[model samples]
Target chain A: MARYATTPSQTVGPYLHIGLPWPDGPFAVAEGTPEGVWIRGVLYDGAGAPVPDGLIETWQADPEGRFDHPDDPRGAVARPGFRAFGRCPTDANGEYGIFTLKPGPVPGPGGTLQAPHIDVSVFARGMLHRTVTRVYFPEEAAANAADPVLSSVPEPERATLVARPAEDGYRFDIRLQGEDETVFFDV
Target chain B: MSTDPTTRPAPPAYARDAEVHPPLDYPGYRSTALRHPKRGLRLLPHLLTEVTGPLLGEDRISENDSDLTRQHDGEPQGQRIIVHGQVRDGDGRPVPHTLVEIWQANAGGRYRHTGDNWPCPLDPNFSGVGRTLTDDQGRYRFTTIRPGAYPWRNHDNAWRPAHIHFSLFGRAFTQRLVTQMYFPGDPLFFQDPMWNSIPDEKARERLVARFDYANTAPEWALAYEWDIVLRGREATVFEDEVDED
Candidate 1:
């Protein structure tokens, strides 16, 4: 079959905040929902400067490992108030936050099980294309160890994908360049 | 052990084509030098999490969200234009109900952002932000003013070609794309490093929107048509195939 080539990606430029952010953007679940934790972090450039113009988006399953998408083989999510996606732009100080419930384990390829993680896409002024990454929970040590994606990453660099435990949730800082750069995926 | 006949295997992941996408380390865009990752990206397996994406319901978009000209009391200043396009998959199937977002400079090439202080007057009525959901036919339209060329510090007297920034989310997470749309036959293409970064001349032309005289409203606004094609899921997923390194 002759398929059409997908359009190329371009930088989000410095003015992304004008269009990307949503009023209820950071909240994957409704505000003040019990057990909802905030995933917070700061985006940094190679020079160690904060990136205030960046945007971060997250996609995750519900606590039961079910998605709200039709592509999920297990079935569509029926939860009334849960929003599986979140879009948050960095503040002036280069900080971003997402309020949501932690996701459970999801199905992986080759009959393996993926650890609790949130799929993230990073868009910034300098990035020609959105960088794909993941946020893993620190508490899921066992599951993280057995994850196929984590296993594929070099042993020393795997820590960049795991979030640190914070007051109400986890903190996963993203570094676009320099040492300890976040593990970007080629998916 | 028997496999369930009713449950079809999930679709394979869409691999990003390097030839079409600009490199992160393109020196033409100076900001990329310090911002691009020094290391290569790791490969991720297509799983339930990757294939499934958030379906942004229609509720998020309110009335007049698609019409930037009607947001304020008075009309925005500039030549009014109607930008319309269709979102499709690699297989040429319409991707219906997807979200399309756009932000651009006002007719004067001045952005509404606080960071943009290039000595240009800001339009109080034009915010330069608009979003809409594609219809059942995968088509989306926006009513707005045509933006002007803007000066940038990339080079000596570098003025960016008039363009509109676009952000799109296809059905799946892997199908996310962000790009810019240009007018057909802009004289500024020769000096714009961002536009020149694309190695392929033909691929670069895809970013230009065609002037649609047929769709132009009699006196209200001129029309420009462009279509966005996104990576589609493979027809048959090979579960056991190893990724070629």
Candidate 2:
């Protein structure tokens, strides 16, 4: 049998806005959805400078811990206004934002529970490939402590994964390099 | 019934053949030095989120979105070409009804973006962007002008090869891919960091599109074909991993 290898990834490049962005891409849930919160942050490089040409995408479950995808073993959940996905391009200041509701705890390996979190993928002009990361809620202390994925990360670096409370929702800045860099994933 | 958690195996994780992909910190690509993460990436289990993604299609795009040449009232300045291909998974199964988007420079090696202030003249009739949903057989086709090579400040007189940027959305988030499709036998490959970044020669070759004489429209336009393959899931059953994760 013939086997095909997966194609490699490349950077989104400087002019991604021409093709990638949708008018309503920042909204994971429909606009004006009750209790919807915004996840906003800036993408910084090792020099501590903002990356204006970057793009960020997010995926997460609904508050009920259910996904609208067919692959979910619990079966797919069809929510009227929940898309469960968000994509946003950075502004001139290199800041990106996504509006979504808090995700519920998800099942983890070994029957453990993962902390309520959002999966994130970052792309930019200079990057050869997108980098993967996760965003956990700051208030989920107990759940975060028991989470298998969170526990695997080194203590100091774990805090970088947790988002800080913001006025409208939560603020979780992503630093591609330098001190206090976010913990990226290899999923 | 078996209640042991161990009895339920984990779902197959996306294959991580590091050598097949470019390193995040390749210095040859000057921009990577300060932008690539310093710490190692932690392993993430393929839970529900990894195996599923948003299904984008018909609602977001239009009929003329696949034809870049006709988007504007007048024709763009360049050699008209038809680029087509099939979207498949690593297992070689066709991925139908998925979204594929592309953007590129004009014939003069200049982008339509405000940030692209290169000295080359911009085509007033070209936006250089197009998109479409794959057909039942995972096939997608586009009508556009062939782009030209452009100079960059990456190194002394750095010029990128003529290429089109591609973005694909497969069945799962893990299967998402973004890559550049280059013209076959371009002289710029040796000096371009982006082209040489891939460690595997065979993997690098996949990025080049092949000229198809059969697909060419006589007296109308030239044709090129390039197939894309996204990552495949592990061979494990969903039932085992759902409970374990």
Candidate 3:
């Protein structure tokens, strides 16, 4: 006898609802911003449960590792039609995704050009404080090794912060707790 | 620009009728299993008043109040800046009476009570948990000190800049958001993983509040104004379906 496999419903889990909360106005400025990059990822608990209401915020550099604002003293490099900033809350399934460009290496303290990475902050209801994490690209392995931040983590744990490239772009998953948990700093 | 007689004319009335929908006995399908009254009833009041509290006066007790001392204890201490903002809906309107909670590291770059052991002294006065309600203007404010930059094992010579973490709940679960706010002049903002995660330039600036000379109190106190928004009732839409697969 042949048996059929039953698939579960997709709408049963938690969803994330995010938006921009800027004091000035709508976060739209025509010039003096970075290029658009795609920032997308999933949120999960230590038990691998999707946190539907989890809120994630990401900030990174433009492709040149230089910021676009006038205040950014790194000097001006123009990339027309690119907007570096965006905000989105995850859906109920604990899945959050954004479309932006990859950032270039930026100067760290002591004039060091830090590796290309995106800074992330995660907020969920039950969490006492926000969890801070980073997402690195796999292609920049050499740079990742040289990264002052990545080098601080143990060799085995470094892989947790580096995202693997997927068909559309890169995929990074963050775990709030438990084994294989991504290293979260207390900044 | 020039006005031209060759401009296209509006479509005829008959064409518009075809695109209109007639009222139906049942507008859309409903699911029995997921049906329930909305949960915003309890959260609405909190969302409305998050922004309008008495500004924290000078000489206020620190958010943390523990009598522990030692480095690498992961206690919350050090100088830190807390940026609180009110969240608004798509229409740029504030949803009042919400809850905003924030927790972050001490000046020495350690959290209040996490297991991580970064070598930093925790302040007995700073517990690092802050709560506030938005006011009638959809505004929320937090009184917090500046977080300190701490070193991590990720890099031999890397240290995170001072920052604060934020968690916001609007009128309902669907309107919640979590994020971190950074200081404007911190040099480490560029190197930190959390700050660089935001891809947009203008949006990234939004995370860093402008240093308001007027909001600055006497040398001892600092103040920041942050606003948050939540989706209102009419804007919410529900879809009914068991499974697509």
Candidate 4:
């Protein structure tokens, strides 16, 4: 009788070592006295567990929605005490915080004062891909309600993106998945 | 559990050739490193040194490094900053089981610790070092106080722009990458030494993120998003084994 046989499975070797340099250290950036509004929050997994050792990066316009760099043709306008960009990592408890001034209304791609918000990107191990989420301020309800981006999301999920007021400043929690998921975007 | 008479054990496919080729076993093939419990995690330190070696030329110690372990001083309030992004493969597929590491300055243009002495006091609660492994979908996030723009010795009266340094590893050394992300509205982008260090314009733009107000929270919080891609699915071809002679 004819019979079929399966070939032996090939053993998988360890991939080349790819690790971060200065693994246990703080990010490098300009040192200035911080000013402006601040937002603080934690990053959690689908199971609602804090992800320690995660990295968080943010970039935004100044209080006047103007960029602080010279490449920006708008020229550097004096927004006294407005620092535009920042970066930080989650603590052992999966908590991260940022302190910046309240961004001003900037002209959007369509010439609109995009709502005051900060752009965010999250990176961690075990993730085959990264997830992107945004943080909004609770006080900017009027602006947020009218924001072009917020308008895109369904009404029920809108609250997930806004930062509620905390004693120190504002606080927002981002969940990678599951219930109460923070609003993540494609871009 | 009665066995059917019709079913019978199958014969070995290579039984006829077994006499010509003696039975072979993969004995003594194990490496000693696997036996150590700490060996797995210990790989990080070596990996970090290789990834960060190139960017060392621009390294400058932050003023806050000295005080990082101390309590937050009431001196000057710092700005708040957030950094978030996704880890994807070359095909934009999420890659899980990868490690990410980040280090940056504090709100005062100072770092938590790097052996640099600046005037800014470190926040006791803020230790700038953070690490995370990607989830099943290849996503990661970090929240921390905004880093301030600090002056450096790169140029006369030169100050670095507010930026976050990012380092990522994607399954292998060939897929490893290290780059810095910049804020959209920083004026110093022009005068900054490191930003100009990158020669390619399109490559340089990769470091900048778009402003998505939808990601933004209230005045107390802000949001940004970034996605990273890694090469994948390549064949491994070996020419020949080295000859002992």
Candidate 5:
């Protein structure tokens, strides 16, 4: 019944790009896949500066709220091309893009149904440990209202986690510090 | 830095001295304190899934992906060395076929990054990047030069110990871990704040790699062995139910 404590985190450093980003690592599913839409955003630092060396990773369930993972009690994902996971590194301008489908709904704490949201983890220089947050779709206004995690945040601060819809996907900008800083969750 | 044990907060894990981890009062670690906001917040299931990772294939690997001793042509300039290690879970079980990537500064104490403006010559042949997969026994090895210590702007005359960044993948995406490995007799151990961040001196020592004399080829290269332990299985019985089909 003993638990092993994982090693503590340290700064991702200015040189993370050399080791973390592999060819097409940003694409969890092969880019240009038909069903999923792209999730795009810019990662910013405390001074409101763009974080060029940052890495953003996300995980989500399929449209039916099911995951292809072994941990998902609901069972395996039905779709072949959908990986439900993506890792994108920021460009010089601090922009990152991931092509994936919009997740539907999943179960929240207890019995409530959670809204469609992608778990986001931001890792960058000066960040000893990754800051955890979430990206919810504004289009899912109904589900977002009843969501447990979303309700936990103050009403004014909840908007930071909702992504604005673009032509094909959603736009969710992440701010590490300063005003309108993204709400980080303890995980 | 007077740390009042009476005022010190702990969930028991981080009760150690934070003053030693220099860049005293680092903003990056501010939110990790005992009284931080996120400490009491409950996490949802979406935040807990540990599945889905890049299933990297050996097809894309070049002839010398694991060899840092030589890149384009000629050998790198430095003391030649070999690093060998295994990836394991807390229960002492091998984590097989996981992707393990390592990056470090060149022998001249310069990283092959645009951010490094340090006045050091770059070795054209050494990019200082190496990637490999753990074998069935959870073992991996790489051949590279011993990285040199580099100065940082943390404090007065602050210098970081020579270290390599390692990324190890577990069965799922959430299980991925990133940590640094240091050489056993590095003089920087006492000075580097990051290495001393762990309150427990014993846990901090785990990060240091042991020198393996037998594996070192008489004069060709020195060998260092480091084993990494990751978060172990939690509620694994329920996890097995999903695969019963």
Candidate 6:
């Protein structure tokens, strides 16, 4: 097997906000933009304690499942006014929020469509490497059932990937450990 | 129940101890199967077709936004210094116009954050957080006071070494990275678990910034340089492109 040496990841440390958050960082789009929802969640450490200073970043596609960059083998086409990427830093209460539109379905490995989901990466004090995971929209149950990525998750543990619906948007609490730990991916 | 990163071969720079990385192991890192790496990760794609960001410095940048050594009124106490370096890809090419953010404790080993109740005196002029975009050469420089070694409860009498945290973001989403740079010649290296966590001895040293006398102004602040290397992208691709075509 061929391998490429990659720079290893390190903890975000106690002062993560120094370098991660910015004045307009947490918005993937303007709040209250039509169809945009607030994706908010609190991060927890293994003892089931809130990690107040953690950093959460999410990346997704526009409503058409199209991208704005040249790497899209399809082409660099963006939905007008769609940012598709956002960064949110947790507050003292351990909650992080981002205002973004629901991501459209993207391609799976073998021509199948992934459910409307967002890629999430977490960085915190004790974590040497950021953990990777996905947040699927609960409302996309019909499409979620057919997603190649979601099906791969163990049946009983699959719900952990879906964010529960809330008053403003969706709530997905990420558990670093303990009962009902959030399902983190290796990537 | 192997806890190793199976998707990619362990980076040559990873720490020598298999379980020394506290975050990878649940409970220790977090005890739960959900914390364990499952097969689903293999199928995930980090790159989306549209994840690029536009230019950042196009607008006016205020002085207070990038300089942390001096805040509202008083200057942060410590050895006044300049932290500057380039952001490069693994290929050693500069990644210009990217954002680099940083935060650190004040020289008194105390943070301006609320969760910190360590009783250390706070610097009236220092909030210890600042950011700026890399220049066209992929170089980023900041003026800040050196952070002080602070105590943590990770172990008995655990004092983290004085260091500054760095966060970088490139055009694409997959291009983000977070790391820390330590001041050279700190006595706390051996005692710090986080420092020892990077198993590769050389990689461990890379985290430390070096003294740059030439860059230091004759009468002004001292200078330190610490460059960061990201993975994957070929930074030099722009070099060979022909605009005439």
Q: Specify the highest-TM-score model's number.
A: 1
> Each predicted model: what fraction of the native A–B Cα contacts (within 8 Å) does it retain?
0.69, 0.62, 0.00, 0.00, 0.20, 0.24
lDDT of 5 by residue, B1-245 (tens): 22432222211111111122222125323322211222223343333243443444464366677889867688889989999988887545777877788899999889998889889888887899988888898899999999999987766677889998887766655455667888988888787767765566777777789999989978689999988876555443323344222
TM-score of predicted chain B versus true chain B for each candidate? 0.91, 0.91, 0.58, 0.60, 0.77, 0.77
Show model 1 residue runs off by greater than 4 Å.
Answer: B1-9, B235-245
What DockQ does candidate 1 score? 0.63
Give lDDT tens digits, candidate 1, residues B1-245. 21641234555666556678888888988888878888888877777888888777688788898899999999989999999999998777899999999999999999999899998898888999988999999999999999999999988889899999998989889888999999999999999878988888888898999999999999799999999988876645434355333
lDDT of 4 by residue, A40-108 (tens): 788887667886645565555566655543323344454444434345667779887776665655443
Residue-level lDDT tens digits of model 5 in A125-172? 666556668899988898899987898888888999999988888888
lDDT of 3 by residue, A3-120 (tens): 1111100111111221222221112223224443345677777566776666565555667775543323333455554434444555668787666677777655433446887666
- Per-residue lDDT over A52-76 for candidate 2, one digit per residue giving the tens place of the 0 to 100 score: 9999999898998778876766668
Which ranges of candidate 3 are over 4 A from the true structure?
A1-37, A69-71, A75-80, B1-245
Q: What is each candidate's DockQ, to 2 decimals?
A: 0.63, 0.59, 0.02, 0.01, 0.29, 0.36
| TM match of model 3 to true structure | 0.40
Model 2: which residue pairs collide? Answer: A107-B245, A108-B245
Candidate 2 per-residue C-alpha lDDT over B140-211 given as tens digits, one digit per residue, 9 for 90 to 100: 999999999999889988999999999998978788788999999999999999989998889999999999
Which residue pairs of candidate 1 clash? none
lDDT of each: 0.88, 0.88, 0.48, 0.49, 0.71, 0.71
TM-score of chain B of 5: 0.77
User: lDDT score, residue B51, model 2?
Assistant: 80
lDDT of 3 by residue, B11-91 (tens): 111101100111111112122112211111111111101111112112222333112111225533443333555656534
Candidate 6 chain A: 10-residue stretch with minimal lDDT? A1-10
Q: Whose lDDT is higher: candidate 1's or candidate 5's?
A: 1
lDDT string for model 1 (A17-70, tens) is 898899999999999999899999999999989998899999998998888888
lDDT minimum window of 10 residues, candidate 3 chain A: A1-10
lDDT string for model 6 (B1-245, tens) is: 33321222111221122221234533322222233333323334343422343334534256776777555776777888899988876545678888777888998999887778897998888888887888889999998887899998776788889988887766555556677889999999888877776767777787889999989977878999988866544323234454432
What is the TM-score of chain A, computed separately for every candidate? 0.97, 0.97, 0.76, 0.75, 0.94, 0.94
- Which runs in model 6 stand beyond 4 Å of their true positions? A1-7, A17-19, A78-81, B1-23, B26-61, B233-245
